[model samples]
Target: MYLTKAKDYLLLCKTIFSFLAGNSSNLISQREMERFMYLICLIFLSDADTTEDVTVVYGIEGKPISINCSYNLKENQWREKSWCKHISETKCQHVVSARRFWMPFLKRRNGTTAIADNIYEGILTVTINPLKKKDAGLYQCKTDFLGVVNTLQKVKVNVLTDLWETEAPEEPRVEQSISSTPSDTETKLHIIVAGLLGFKFLIAVLILIIARSLKNRTTEDGYRRENEHQLFPVTGNGYYS
Candidate 1:
């Protein structure tokens, strides 16, 4: 019985140790993965200068906007370059390609997107005329060097309406001033009412005190007269006994 108990205790301890070991391994893996991701982000940020991914273009609705994507291709070997709009977190839709002229659909849409490449200057320019609200999205410019994807940059395009341009900004301040006057007046009125009620209460308390004093004096005088009559009963008419 003693041996069996020892074996069972050992088994329980072993199982607990195994669980702890597995948990430790998982924590280590998680830490390593986090470190790896941090390194990758650092690399991406460091390469932003070369890739020109830091530019965010803003445009107003019914206006025009241009995005400049500069690249550093070795030996001026710019094999291909493409512009795409981000559809989801992990997917993008190709809008136009500078290397090929096969995007007839984009051309049909009033040729709103015009991509120009300056091979000598290593610059790619994308212009969108008459920008609409639907043009607001995340765009990416990717370069292919020697048939391999090399440099990639992303730019976010924000299209805002001109509603604020025509509205009166001072109207809100005027309304605020008007709204605040009533509250101040109400506060003063409350204070005045409270003071009047307190004055009335003081006057009532003074009246009650004066009435109590008069009643006490009258009672004292009546008691004195009764005592005198009891001590010296009236002898025949007004003679003292």
Candidate 2:
């Protein structure tokens, strides 16, 4: 039984060591390797504590922002959790803690910052309200487990001063419909007016021609009667004189 227990313990330690070695080998950045080593030591040794730096986060100025930190506890029991601002590579300023008093500088708040933790899910969230340009900096979330302080994650927040603006396209103007040809009703009315004027002109010309013909016939008849009277003298009683 003693041999079996010893073998199991050795196996567990081997697994952990292999995992740490594999992770360290995969890291390309020297800073990342250093952070990995720090975390490994914090986990293996009681007196050592370290923070693992994470990805950078971006936020627009005057906006609310939330940063998430996730970690695996690996069966270790955590007694406390904290959120801090990175002062330097090897130092941090504690802002809030799960089981401790808030830092003196953070005691008075304008409802601008908060932190929450989920022990079961191993997630820590830091929130900032109305984020300003001054809030752009490095931050860390840490946990105290097995009498050792270990960094869950670190983040660099960058607050942008310029907010994106989208201009809506101008609405297209509606053009009034134009027609080159007249409507059916107007065209018909115009044709009728032209026909009426042409009929009136034709009637006037016919009337003038008939009147001239009648005047010429009347003059000829009078001249013939005068010639007959000059050619033969007619008695006053209806005979030629």
TM-score of each: 0.41, 0.40
lDDT per residue as tens, model 2, 110-153: 25777766556666667888898878888888887667878777
lDDT by residue (68-138, candidate 1, tens digit) is 87777464334577788889978878787774334321322226887766666677778899888899888
Give the alpha-carbon lDDT of every model. 0.63, 0.63
Total backbone collisions for each predicted model: 0, 6
62: Cα error in model 1, Å = 0.8
Clashes of 1: 0
